[model samples]
Target: MTGRKALSRALDLSLWKGALTTAGSREAADAVTERAVPNEPTVRLTAVRRLYEVSTRMGAGRSLAETLQAVVDGVVTGLGFGIAVLNLRHPDGKFEVIAVAGSPEAREALLGTVSAADIFDGEFKIADEWGRLRFVPHERLPEGEVVGWVPDVPVSADPSAWHPLDALFAPLHSPDGELVGMLSVDLPEDQRRPGPIHRELLEIFATQAGLAIDKARLTDQLLAEKVRLEASETTFRLVFEGAGNGMATLAFDGPEAGRVLRVNDAFCRITGYPHDRLIGSRLLDYLTDGDAGRTRRELQELATGTGPYRFERTFRRADGQDIWLGGTAVIVAQGKDQPRILLIQIDDVTARKDAERELQHHAAHDPLTGLANRRLLQHRFEAALQRSRQRGRRGVLLFSDLNHFKQVNDRYGHEAGDNALREIADRLLTAVRHGDTVARLGGDEFVILAEEIDGTDLDALIRRVEESIGRPLAGIDVPVTASIGTAVVSPYSADLDELLRTADQAMYEAKHRDR
Candidate 1:
C-alpha cells in the first residue's frame, strides 16, 4: 500500500477503536486497539473526541435542519468520508437531499434535490447489506435507473478499488423502526470499498445521529401543532364575534352541561341579556315559562349526543317579554380526552312567528264578521262531538236566519250591511256562554255550538240569543229579527250533515211560522 493508503487504513482503525470505547466496553476497545494500530493512542483519542463533539452538537437544542446538517458534517469529518448527504423522507413519500457535507460544487448540485421513494426502495432491495450500511456496487445498478450524485472518479481494475458509481448508504430510523432518513457517503480516504470496521463505525454514529434527528423532528412537530392551534383559536374568535346571528358554545358533560360557556354579542341582543347574566347560565333558564321544562329535556337529549337538534323555541327576554328563536345545536368533540361541547347558532324569529300565527287565524275565521268560518266551525264541531261522546254529555246547535236581512243590505249598501253584521256578531257572542262556538255559515246565517247542556238550559240559551238578534241596528231604522232552529246532540250524534240539515229544516219551518 502507498503511504496515503496506509495512513487512511490507520485512521479507519482508530475510528473503530474509539466507537467501541464510547458505544460499548473499554475491554472491547482495547481488544480492537491492540489488534490494529496498537501504538496510535493519540489518533484513537482524536477520533473519540471528534465523535463526542459531533454527537453533542447533534443532540443539542437546535432545529431539525441544523441537526441534520450536523449529522452529515460529522459523517464526513469524523468517519473519514469525502462526501456525505442526508436525505430526509417527506410526507409525500419522496426523499429530499437536505444536508450535504462535501465540496461546494457537490453541495450545490445535490442539496434540495429530490428522489422518488421507489428509487431508494430499489437500491436498498438490490444492494449488499453491510450490517446496517447498504453498499451498491457500480456493476449492480440497473440500466436507466438514476440514483443520486456520483463523483467524477475512474474505476480501477482492482476488485476492491472505489468507483465513481458505487453507492454507500446508512438509513436512519426512529425508535419505532420507521425509516426517517438516509445518509449517503462516497470517496473513503483509502480509495477502496469500506471494511467491516469502517461499516461498524458508521452504524454506531448513525444510531446516535438518528435519535438526535428524531428528537429534533418531534420538537418541530410540536411547535407546528401549537402554532396551528393558536391560529385556529383566533379564527374562531373572529367568526363568532362577527356573526350576525346569535352563537353560543355550551358545556356538554357533567352538571354544567347545557350551560353557556361562550356567547356572541348577537345572543345578548336577541335575549335582551347582558354578557354577565348569560355566561355560565343554563340555556333552559331563558326559556319561556310554559316551555322551560320541555326545552330542558330537549337540551338534555342534545348533551347525550342525540343531536343535532333544529328547533324553534320561545325564550323569555331579560325584561320578561317572550321572543321566538329558530336555532340549531350540534355537539363538537374537542379531543379524545377533552370534554365535548355544544355549538348553538340561533336567529331571532319572533316577527316571522307572529306573522305565521296571524295567517293561521285568518285562514280559519270569517274576514267580514271576525267570527269562525265554516272551516273552523267544522273542526270545532268534530272536537265537541268527540268530547260529548266520550263523556256522554248532551250538546246543542242553534241555527238562526235574520228576517228581512236582504232588504237592509239593499237599502244601506254593503258597507252598512257589514257594520250591521259585525254588530250582530258582537251581540250573539255576548249573549252566549264563553265556551260556545259562534260561527257564520254564510250571509244572514249564524250557528252556535253550545256543548254540555240540557233541554231547560237550551231553551234559556235560545231565548237569550233571539232577544240579542231582535235589537234594531244602530245607524239604520231597518228592523231585523232571527228565525231560529235547534238540533240537540245525543252522545251518539256522529253525522254533522244530518244535524245541520235538521236545523235547516227547523229554521225554514220557523220562518214560515213568522211569515
Candidate 2:
C-alpha cells in the first residue's frame, strides 16, 4: 500500500478538528470549512484543500519518524512530485536522508544516507532563490559533485522541462527559524519545472512539517520528565515510610502552620496516636503543659528559619505518659507553587533522659547525708547573693560544728558516730526556713544559707540551730551539741569565701566559750 494510504488508515481523521484546535489556528480551519468563491479556479481550490489535508494528517499525533515519512509521501502523491527526500540536520551539522517517497527504489537507496553540510552549501551557492524555495536548474549544476538522492530520469528536450539533474529544495525550519531539515523534490508530474504557484504550495507544506516535528519533540521531552518524577516519588515513599525513626511532615506556613500534614507509622507508634486522629492536629498539643509555652516559642523561631535544627523535647503520649524525643527537623521553604514544610524525624529518648536526670541528681547531692554537697552549696550561695543584691534584701550564712565530734567517735565507735551525724543532719533540715539550703561540708561541719533575714530573724535562726543540734542522739548514749556562728549578708555581700571565714571564726569562739 502507498505510505499515505497506510498512514490514513492507521490515524483517525476524527482528530482533524482537534488538531486544528490545538494548533490555535482558527484561520486554517476556516479556510477548510469556508465555501469556495464564484468561478474560483478548480485547480487552486483543490490544491488548497490538499495542503490542509496534509497538515492535519501530520498533526494527528503520530511518532516523529512516521510523521516525517507522511510529510515526504504527501509531497510526492499529494503535491504531484515524482520523488521527494527529507534530509534531517544532526548536531554535527550533517544532514541524513531520514525519509523518502514517490519511488520505491529511491526510498530504499536514499533512506539513512548522509550528506555533508558543505555539499548542500555548494549546491545552494549556484541555485536561484525562489522566495523560500531554492531552484537549481540542470545547466547551473556543478560538475563532479553529487548533491542529494538524484533519481535516474532522462533529461527533457525542452529548455523549461523538468530535468533529472535539476534540484529543488524547501528548507524546513523550527518555529525559532533554525533550519532543522531540507525537503528536496524532483520530476513534477506535469513534466515541467514547478511555477511560482507550485513553489508556494510546497513552501506552505514544509512550514507545516517543521511545526509538527517541533511539537513531537516537545511531547517526547514532557513524557521523559514525567517518568523521572514518578521514579523519584517512589524512592521518597519507600524511605519515608520504612524509616526506623519516627517521621512527620508538618505545614510550616499559612493557617496550617505547626499542624501535622502526614506522619509515618513510627511517629504514630511513638505518640501512641493513630494516623487518622493525628492529621491536622498541632504537634504542640502533645507537649507537656510545663513545656508547651517554651516549646512553642522555639518552634516559632525554627519556622522562621533560625535556631538549631537539633532539639530535645518532652511530649505527652496518648496514655498520659511523658516521652522524650531527640531529633532534627528540616525546613523546606515555600517555592513558587510549593508549600512550606517541616520534615521532623526523631528517636525515642525517654530512657536516656531518665538516666541523665539520675546522674545529675547524684552529682549534686551528698550520698551520705542526702543533702546538698559542697558543689551544690556554692551554686545556691551565688544565686542567693544575686537575689539579695537585686531585691535589696539581707541574708545570713550560719556555720556550725559538733562539739568534740572526734570524742563521740572514740567513745561510741565510728558506727555510732555515723548514726549521731544522721540525727544532726535531720535536725539541721528542720531548723532552717523553707527555700534555705543546708549543706554538709564533710564530717561534723554543716552550713545553712538563709535569704531575706533581718537582725532579729538572724538571732532567732541561730538559737534554733543550737537547740536542734543540742538534743540527745537517737542511738548513741553520748550527748550531742553544736557551736553555731552567723554572718550577716547585705546587698553589699560580695565574697562567699569571706562570709564563710567570718562564720567559721565565730563558731570557734562559741566552742571555746561553751567549753
Candidate 3:
C-alpha cells in the first residue's frame, strides 16, 4: 500500500508537470524515487537565513489583518516569490482573499482587480487538497478565460515591473488536518518550477504563519479590552473632579476612622485645603458632630447594607467661618478581606438657611417700624391665653388708640404725624417688661399683651403707658395722647375676640370721658 501511495503521488506530480507544459515523465515509480533526495546544504542554509529574517519582520503585526498581511509579505521576501496572497476559509467551506503583498505593479493591479470582483470578502470554490499546492503555467491558463477573470489588471500600466505569468497555490491546514486557508505565490519566470527543497521551505512558512495569526488575534482582543476599561475610568474621573458639589471618601474603621482618604477638586475647594493636606486628616476636624464614633456607626450601617444617610451640618472652612452644608453619606463595601469605606457628598446651604429665617421674620413683623404686626400679636395672644388657663396667672390685653391722631395729621401734614407715630411706637416698646408683646394693628391702633401680672402690677403697667405716650414727639409739634383700656383674660374666658372687644369698649369710654 505504501508503494502504491508513492506511485500515486509521483503520478500526481507528473500530471502537474504535463499540464503546465508539454513535458513527459519517466516511469512513475522510478520518477518518484529519483525526486526524493535532499537538496544541497548551501541552499538549505540560504533559505534558513531568509526565513529567519521574515519571521522577525512578521512579528510587528499587532492585529489580525496586519498579521495576515505580514504573512503574505514574508512569503514574497523570504521564499523570493514575485507575488504572495493569503486567503482565508469561510464557514461556507469556500476561500476568500484577505491580504496581499508583492511587486509594486503586480500588487496594485491584482488588488484593484480583486476589489472590483469583491474577492476579498467573497467566496470561491477550492478543494481540500489545494491546501497541498497547485501550479498554473502561463501557457496552460487560457488568456480568454483566466485573463478575462482579472479583466481590470491592465498589462500596459507598467509592463517592465509586472510579469507573473505562472502561479502556485499552497493551502494551509491546522495540525488536525483541518484546512484553515491558502497562500498563493507567483514565481519569477526563470524559476517557475521550484524544487522539492523550495516547496518544503514554503510549507514551513505556512505553519509559522498559522501560529502568528493566532497570537495576533489574541493580542488584538487584549488591547480592545484595555481601551474599553480606560474609557470607563476616564468618564468617572471627569464626573468626580468636575462636579459643582463637594465629594470625598473616608476611612470607616480602625484608628483612622473618619479620616479623609481622598477628596476631589470640589471638596478641596469647599474646605479650603490642598489635596495633599486634606488626605489623611480626620474629617471630624472640619465637621460638626462627625466624630469617629458616629463614623463607625455609619460604617456599620453600610456593612449591613442599610441605606444612605442624610443630614444638615456645619463645616468649618480654613478661614474659621462656619458654613452650613447639606450632606448625604453612604457606606461602600469593598468585598471580603477589604475594609469598607464611606462616600459623602456635601453642598453649601448657609445662604438658603439664612434666607429662610429672613422670610419668617418678614412674614410675622411690620416692615416699616420693625415691630410685631397683628399676625405676631395674635400668635402671642393665643400663647398668653393658654398660659393663664394653665398657670392660674393673671394676664391683660390692652388696646390703645392715639387721641386726635387724624387731627395731628390734618394740622401738621402726614409726615409729622408719621414722626409722632414713630415716637409713640418707641415709647410703647420701652414702657412694658421684656416678656410682654407690643403690636401695631395698622394706622393709629396699638395693642400690648402683658402676662403673669396681679391687679396692682397691671395698674402700674397702665400708668407707665399713659406717662410714656404723654411725652412730646422728638421732631413733630403734635400732642399725641393715648386712650388706653384693659381686659382681664379669665381662666373660663379664653376667647381672643371677646377680650379684644371688651378692651375696645373700655377705650371708647376713656376717649368720651376725655372729650
Q: Write the residue-wise lDDT of candidate 3 on 43-82 in tens digits.
A: 5555655665665556555577776777888876778665
Q: Where in model 2 is the C-alpha error above 4 Å?
A: 1-242, 304-308, 333-338, 407-416
Candidates 1 and 3, the one with greater TM-score: 1
Estimate every model's Cα lDDT from 0 to 1.
0.71, 0.69, 0.61
User: Which whole-number lDDT from 0 to 100 does residue 208 have in model 3?
Assistant: 52
Q: Sort by TM-score, best first.
A: 1, 2, 3
Error of 2 at 340 (Å): 3.2
Angstrom error at residue 420, model 1: 1.2
Best-fitting candidate, measured by TM-score?
Answer: 1
Tell me each candidate's TM-score.
0.54, 0.49, 0.48
Total colliding residue pairs, candidate 1: 0
lDDT of 1 by residue, 336-399 (tens): 3456667676778889899999999999999989999989988989999889889999898888
> By the lDDT metric, which is better: model 1 or model 3?
1
Higher-ranked by lDDT: 2 or 3: 2
Model 1, residue 214: displacement in angstroms? 48
